[model samples]
Target: MRTALRRRLLPAAAVFLLAALPACSSSSSDSGSGSGSDAAKATESGWSFTDDLGKTVKLDKAPTRIAGVNDQIVPLMNYGLEPVASWGYSSIKDDARFDDLDTSGVKQVGTAYGEIDLEELAAQRPDVIVSEVYPTDEKGTIDESQPDYGFKDLDQQKQIEAIAPVITIKLGGDGADVVERTTEFAEALGADAKTVAEAKERYETASAALTKAAKDNPVTVTSLYADTDGVSVAKAEDDPALNLYAGLGVKFFEPKPKGYYWGNYSWENAGQIGGDMWLLQQAGYDTAQLKKQPTVADDAALAAGQVHPWVSAALDYVSQADYMEQLAGWITDTKPLDD
Candidate 1:
């Protein structure tokens, strides 16, 4: 069974629109019937996409009035294709995913925990909606019942689809893959090549610098999430953020129990898994409260002020680059407490 913490940790939205959708509806299915001529015409006209679901979403022209989920909006903006509207797990101001973004112009269709404003979203009249898709099978079958990135709940999904074609890229891959796929989607939507190229260059530079810094400093890092229930250490192989950090040369503390993305621990046992630095997942919780947790306070890294913000869902290139720079700076600025 997937842990509740897994769902809570991700920025992706949940499905809550089952009552509104037909029992046997295929609204979000990839089996839309389109003629061969239509496919040829789409290729000639300029915009077409075979999403992760194998569904072909076509446009007469590149979409200018775009709508996206919170995590997706930032990347679209970075590629110079800002969405006209967006919905997210929190208000624009509160979501760290969009800290560097200027979302003043983009209309907020909904905020926090999959609550979407159908009327407002309809008002946007978007040509297409973009979001991240999670694959359910080895053959790339996506779970279409739920919208990704906290855009809409199950009941509101079909309603949102009625307003626009929902295009999605697969989620849960390496950070580099996420950047490449997101850029490809943006490019298809008419994002400026120069802007995308610049973002990619920035990411590459930051990643290289981070890798080099880790090599020189060699600090052991651990990623964790703490709540009232307990604390959990994230597995590097299972989490994209942790994997990215590991790829950049930071060594992570391995948990005793294997095969799961996160290992649950009581507050008292959190310090057993030692590290020179700790990355605390900061989503859906108060950082101040987290700092005050007995487990966190007891950890050597946390007590020594070696704790850093770990935005697990920062999939976009610009955010990833910024995070890389932050980690690199931390590595260079502080000496290992264990040393």
Candidate 2:
């Protein structure tokens, strides 16, 4: 298996960073100005900034049009930017909440690993395109034999740049922490601080509740994904979804060998394992079907209700604040979901 170490860079990580990585470069597309005083103007809404890739990108002035592929759709919606096109065809049901935002209507792009219907995307004339690209074994071929979310390189970001200014968010890493990244998107969109502040408050409130719960009754959380082998458990140390539970002070099942790649294990043997909460991070399958395996078993989580499915709309950005709220709500019974 290829090493999974590099996939941890989260989009929010950029907030804590200003230095560019060797593989990435600031966009040279927008050469507006770079002076201290000019920097202020450049950051203003509608202005463009050169990204680390050197691409001159014009931030959406009235950014009414957008295109998001894969999980990128969630962050776009989290920042209140509805896309004109989405690439998750089979997972469209997974995005009902986001669809509700722009009830006007949107075009369904394509999603063969986010291959996308470039013609359709181009037709939309989006001001921004958000995508995650991982290095594949061949230039155009995507290796399905891999485990890490398929984001192996920044080439996809570069490709999107040809369409529009693209901002690549890192998928792995403790940096950015979700809320920070959401804030950055909000900042990019010139979204009102009220939205950002409310998200922050929700996260803080949720995190506090989870912390209290953890002190008295810490729970272990695990995120399982379907792999070619069988049921594959992504180590908590690197999986962002599981990382939330860890941050909330809950005990997470850390595998003996931890890395970004999915660890293989039989579903029939899942019952031998124990966790206070079994979070089903269903990328594209029914949890009921997964539970039927011999290794897995019916439980209180599914019965009395401890099994929490990651709500796509609820934790849209997985922003730090969003993480806090998600962890809090998932663990605490203090308030209703609307609360």
Candidate 3:
């Protein structure tokens, strides 16, 4: 699963919307008539759409044989694209939201993060592949300091396209906006208008609840990453993380360099990286060891307990809704009141 802040994480400008759309996109199996309005609708008709790479490929004319390579089952499920093949079943295994799936019928490939074995992916021959954006050092930037994982945002996705056209949706933001990304994919796949409308309505409902929750108590945002070396907080200024929070009008402790995941601050620079509320993404280790690290323990937010560990590890794919709910609660639940 990916982690992105709920607010302040969109591209500097609005992303371009796909051009064609049927009026009421719904998720339905094309019946025998195939000649009815279902087939007549121009927008929700095929999977041979342009990918993030801007290449046009036809995988499905309303793909029935779908493979979900990335971690975005909910949207595809909502879009009515059932996975004939998956990286693994772990993501849907635990969540109640995906009770509709039947794992016995689907092929289990592997994990979502690593490079796919082209031979294996080709063998499945899915009509469409949906993927999630890989985590970067920060938006539009790379973490040069960490060389082993250069951490390029779209690197793995570029390779997926060589197999088939793929749509990369950034996680982190008001969950509703993810539908827009879904719509783009649907247009590519010829998704039904009813599906797009339903997804949009779902997003609108979630956004409204978040808006009310913010009015009840504003949220503060933060991002964290932990590996064997230590924990580093993100100071992001764009897509998924910051953008999600911005959508809710929540505030977070701002970091230096203005735009990046929370910066790497040492003991000397710790004072500057503070926030009224803090959310952390802790590595799975003895909590005591994390508390000993100055970066994890000595920080002001950690001291006061205004910090909560945001959970993304349990999920197979992180969607906009997942990020919004996790971070929104992390921020709101930790709100500091005047004592």
Candidate 4:
């Protein structure tokens, strides 16, 4: 972790989205995201999987050309699936989340919210199109399902579904179960078992190291995302990845979230909670501007230079391993608040 917690703007091709740490309002684990039963069942080159929405996609033969939203395409690529096209917050070429994977030949049809080049995606002739959903109500808790979080509306979802059987999965929980379930999906998609196994081992190893660090240097960690809109104090217990960290012995700055995943407040009221460690969003949070707020200006963590840039890890073994190792190192370096 850099002491300054520096993060520069991404390239013009890259775009930002609020979908990061996609929240779940339901207090129960995995409620915000869909159930964990969406596994790929393969039989003699045929494929079938039940999506989070309870929709079942059965293809007579496994689709050779797979397409997914930006968030999921990278993980499948790591699993040895070559995507023909992608649509998401950022193109694969510019998305930092895919920095570890080679996305040289994939086509990007969408780069921002509520926009997708359907014709362009159709040109790819994908066998199956995949997407992740975190359907939530206005209050930000899980509610009636949305067709596709990436598309503009129900019409767009219908158009895409017309082109190929869309396999949608709900993502939530402490992060471990989703990884395991998705591995089953990748395997069904014909992912190389050796590669997947190797990555899983690394993930487990990193998680163990994180658990050790949390026990050695105990500190209550706070997660924050700030911009011109306002400050959001994330309910660590509500966020799947943060909750996973909590289960690993790391104490989070647990506060009652008024909304789904966060408690929104004006900058004036931003410093409502105190913590030994502060993890700010790497991309959007503006700490320099936040100093204008009296409460944030006097925040002990900021004054002590204990702020760290938090990377929103992708939901995969590779991404999780990197994030965990980095976080574990930071936890080891962080001192207790009382110190």
Candidate 5:
């Protein structure tokens, strides 16, 4: 889930019409009838990408001065493409997902999603902006009328699109959705093929490991932002990684997305949420901190220490593999706390 500040702890991003996307892409899937965009193609004359909205973006040369949302930028960096500027939700600054990657020289134009220092982004002079698209409803529909997942709206999208072409990568069903699409885009942008290939190999291994662990364990999990006041449980349908994890046979607690991206519950009532295990934020909200909550002392998962950190990594095979590897360990080791 793209955590948002709807409550106090979670963070969300800015979206736009002509927006941004992620990096590290392989060959694009052949366009199905009515898919609305052509497959991304590169040639000596120029480069072109069919963005998430089915818009084909053409440029005279592959863009080097890349700038866009941090979620995507980090993956591009994994593939050896450095972005000039990046803006998005607060996750860029403090999330564990971006912990190891050094974003030293990259200009931060936005601290919160949708909020950006236009002048600061403009100062970087990016050649292209990349962002993502998300589903609007439960059925995984990518409505073009909805704003792209990195900028605020059509107005904000146009304001930035005036600076350069915006390439959007949609957050799709499985972990590989954005990773594969980003690989195609990154390759088009001249990312190293060897590095991308190696990353893909690691990803395949981790994915297999996760599948085996999940199939063997059969433990249901719940992912949430557990705060002092309440918990905001993530809706798997809204998170690309969780969707992938589910496909691998991880049984996530099915919560109706009643709020923005999750279902809300008070700390007093949090224990009522059912799951064999819990996927939680890594730091600050530790067992000690959670014990401060009313029901944490009695919660089965908490008592059993059946909690693991949640990771929404950069949509690249490298990062995805790392997270999946970690997740597989947790699943393989954890005993079910619930029936």
Candidate 6:
């Protein structure tokens, strides 16, 4: 009777041990699965973004020390992302493009064209660099040889990149598209969402008003930049300001063949590009000097004061809205030119 009892107890113990072995194996599998999930979350939370160049930039954490080109800085600021340092362009004072920006605490990395103070920029210890990338080919490749907004030329690009990751936004999109992309970039940098939303709302409202005004008073408009040497008639579709005007119902003057951004015309024949009104690119020439030119002075639109300021590179929505409002007011105030 004792031998039979021992045999039954031994079999029961073996069965219990087998059951415990499966439970331990299941626990190990669950632990491994949990570790993989944690790693995925860690990757998701890390700082990583794909720039316009299609390069993925990564950092240990979200960047705080940011730098940008002057033209790029104002838009970032409008979205509530302030930069620590900026290069390209000059002081915002008296510049219409930067009229809405405040650059009080930001350090100027470079003030002149094709010049960057690398020592000054490096001293800022920027976590990231922001700028506009202009495409050179149909494949949308950046022209590294050409000067970008943040750096004067490609010569200092490596040094700048060595300091921090460079994030570039493509510059050729329309006004609304640009605003959307800029908002996305700013949000990625931890800008206040509510503030960016408010700004976007304001822009849309202003844009609607301008469109209505433009529809009410339809007219032909042309954009030109003139100097003593020659005049460059802007390709309306290529320039942001002119594109906005075209979107608002104004008929743009298209040059013959219609591919290039600017059609170069001698000062003698500048007036031949006919339009009911003219939008002047107000750089490298003064108002008085422009008015003094025979071709510009003799043009019916110029003579009638139907000329408005056009910033080809205007980026910020507020600045674009302000410019559109001014254009709308001009359209409302002036009589359409006789055909």
Cα lDDT listed for each candidate:
0.68, 0.49, 0.47, 0.69, 0.72, 0.63
Model 4 lDDT per residue over 1-339, tens place: 111111111212232222221111111223222333344555785556665555666776666788878767777887878888897755566677878677777888888665788777777777778886652423324344445657666777777776777776556655576676666667767789899999999999999999999998888888877777666667765566776788788888865547656667776666676788888885565667667767688788887788887776767788788889988998888877644
Q: What are the models' TM-scores? A: 0.82, 0.67, 0.63, 0.84, 0.82, 0.81
* Candidate 6 deviant stretches above 4 angstroms: 1-45, 137-141, 144-147, 257-259
The sequence of per-residue lDDT tens digits that candidate 1 reaches over residues 1-339 is: 134345434443443332332111113335542323332133555566656555676666666788877777888887767688997767888887677677777999878656777667767767788766554433434566666645546656666776777776666546566666676677777778788778889989999999999999888887777777666787776665566778778788887755457777776776577778877777534457766866666656767888787674456677788889998998876567764
**What are the clash counts of all predictions, listed in order?**
6, 39, 38, 0, 23, 0
1-339 per-residue lDDT for model 5 (tens digits): 234432122242343322443232322324521121245555787767777666666766667889988778888888888889987667466755566777887888887767877667777877778887766656667766756776677777777776677787777566556577778788878889898899899999999999999999888889877665677787775677887778777889976537545787877667678787889855236767887777766788888888887765677888889988999999888888776
Write down the lDDT that model 2 would get: 0.49
Tell me how many residue pairs clash in candidate 6.
0
Using TM-score, give the best candidate's number: 4
Ranking by lDDT: 5, 4, 1, 6, 2, 3
- Candidate number achieving the greatest lDDT relative to the actual structure: 5
What value does the lDDT take at residue 193 in candidate 2?
63
Candidate 2 TM-score to native: 0.67
Cα-lDDT of candidate 4? 0.69
Cand. 6 TM to true fold: 0.81
Off by over 4 Å in 3: 1-47, 88-102, 132-179, 187-196, 227-230, 257-259, 267-272, 282-287, 294-300, 311-319, 322-332, 337-339
lDDT per residue for candidate 6 within 71-117, as digits (tens), equals 67777777777789886645456444556567776788776554667
